[model samples]
Target: MTKRLQLADIGSALIVLFCLVPFYWMIVSALRHPADQFATTPFPLPVSFQNLAAAFAERNGFGRALLNSLIVAGTTTLLTLAIGITTAYVIARVEFRFKNVVLAIIVATSMFPGVTLLIPLLKLFVGLDWINTYQALVLPSLSFGLPLTVFNLTAFFKQLPSELEDAAQVDGCSQWQAFRAVILPLAMPGVFTSGIITFIAAWNEFIIALSLTNDQKMRTAPVITALFTGQYKFDQPFGTQMAAGVAVTVPLVIGALLFQRRIVDGLTAGALK
Candidate 1:
């Protein structure tokens, strides 16, 4: 048993190292002076913030792009949770005709390719004159985010015992009151998990962002990062790109680290049921 445990520990360490090496290299590249960026050294000898600075410089407008991402992702998470939670609760706790069919349909939407809906969405947004606006970003993001949120929350709501809700009703609470005061609080782990997943999806989404917005000012971080140009003629500014990657990655990393336990609990909440 001890020998097996040691082998497992070694294997896990190796896998973790394999996954982290690229991220470490990206940080090294972002911090290295441009002259030494391509060097074979594992660590930068003379570190510099120039690459990070350049990526966020006024000329690049990555700062504005980052803000745009935050707005879109944050708003999408909120809206998805709001609508999805109610819909999930109804599906989980209520008995109605074709309820299983409704759930199957909701889950099915998530499997459709985003690209398939791009043209119709673009046309709809154009008709609404939402082009180059934040709504253009937020609305389409909901299409993708809502289904997952509903599915996860539905599963979580099902796992919660109904006795607590019944007790709330016995105490003079209405159904909505019970949901808001009792069930919602207890299902916070699933909520956090769904919110984080939705936020990350919106934050990292590039194709829809690119297709919807024409103005650079309205562009999100992922789109701006893809279109980043070098200072010198014909150069790609690999260092600056890496810096932008790190900047885009930091929030997600922090969120995951802080809420990892909740995320796991949420994902596993309805698995046994």
Candidate 2:
């Protein structure tokens, strides 16, 4: 048993190192002087903030892009969770016609390639004059976000003890009140999991944001980061790009660290049930 435990620890350490090496390289590159960015050394000899400064340079509009991502992603998470909570409650608790079909359809929508919907969505946004607006970004993201939210939350709700709702109702709580008061608290892990996933999806989404928003001012961090070109033509600015990558990655890392347990619980909630 001790030998097995040691092997497992070693394996886990290796896996974590494999995943983190690229991120560490990005940070090292981002902190290296632009002139020394291509040095084979894995560590920055003398750390510099120039790459970070360049990434957030006023002309690059990275700050605005970051704010735009926050607005769109935050709004998408909120809306998806609100609707998902109610929809999941009904699907989990209420018996309705074609219920399995409905759940399957919701899951199926998430499986559709997002790229295929871009052109039609772009045209629709154009018609509505929503181009370069928050709504344009949020609406298309919902297509993917809502389905997963519903699927996860539904599974979580199903795993919850029905006695909680029954007890709430016996205390004169309406169905809505029972759900809002009794069910929601118990389902928070699932909600956090779904919300974090939705937020990350919206934050990292590129093609749709690129296709919909023509203006740089409305661009999200992922879109702007992709378009990052250095001061001169054909200049890749690897250091600056690395800085942008680190900037874009920090919030996601922080969120995952904070809610990892909840995410794990949410994913495994209904597995036994």
Best by lDDT: 1
lDDT of 1 by residue, 75-137 (tens): 999999999999999999999999999999999988888899899989999999999999889
What are the per-model numbers of colliding residue pairs? 0, 0
Candidate 1 overall lDDT versus native: 0.92
Worst 10 residues of 1 by lDDT: 264-273
Q: How many pairs in model 2 have backbone atoms within 3 A of each other, for residues 3 or more apart or on separate chains, i.e. clashes?
A: 0
> Which residue pairs clash within candidate 1?
none
Candidates' C-alpha lDDT: 0.92, 0.90
Clashes of 1: 0
Let me know the TM-score candidate 1 reaches against the reference structure: 0.95
- Model 2 TM-score on a 0 to 1 scale: 0.95
